[model samples]
Target: MSVDPVEQWSGVLDRFEADIALAVSGGEPVPWNPPVEAEAGPLPEELADRARRILDAQLESMAMLGKVRNDALAHLDALSAVPDSQSSAGPLFLDVQG
Candidate 1:
């Protein structure tokens, strides 16, 4: 028996939702099932709209993660650029008269 298009879309939506939830939970990485345009193209308007919304949320999440990764790398680079304190013969902190 052929699967109903609506049912197929629902299944896809369900998987995406679960994966999104897993991502937010900080759980193990999801084997994300991104929607394929060929399969999604024939979906009914309402279901397609739902899929688009999910895709948008995923895109936002990915952009956020990219920003966070870049920020973390920048911090690491900053720390690495700091000169090693051990190389100096001077005391670690200069006593401020304040």
Candidate 2:
């Protein structure tokens, strides 16, 4: 028997939500691979709210990841701007003969 489109759409959302949940649960290995596409076409009115919730969560995750990327890049840039210790003529620390 063929599954109804609405049922298929609901299942897509269910998987999407579960994936998001796994990511949010703070597991380092939980990959963020989302469904390639919903394939259900236009969403039905009944599932609109659920879809909106998923979209909101996705946006938030994107924003959070963007911040993390920017922060890491900034740190990398700062480190790169610093001269290497080997390049300096003097020792990094002053040694007391006493």
Per-residue alpha-carbon lDDT of model 1 for 3-96, expressed as tens digits? 6678777888888877776776666875665667676547777787788989998897788778878999999999999889989777888779
Error of 2 at 52 (Å): 0.6
Candidate 1: worst-modelled 10 consecutive residues by lDDT: 32-41
Counted clashes in each candidate structure: 0, 0
Clash pairs detected, candidate 2: none
- lDDT for residue 41 in candidate 2, whole number 0-100: 63
For each candidate in the order shown, give its overall lDDT on alpha carbons. Answer: 0.79, 0.78
Model 2 lDDT tens row, 1-98: 75577887898888777767766665464454543455566678899999999999978876877787799999999999998998999789876985
* Strongest candidate by lDDT: 1
Badly placed stretches (over 4 Å) of model 1 are 33-41, 83-98
Clashing residue pairs, backbone N/CA/C < 3 A, model 1: none
RMSD of candidate 2 to the truth, in angstroms, is 4.2
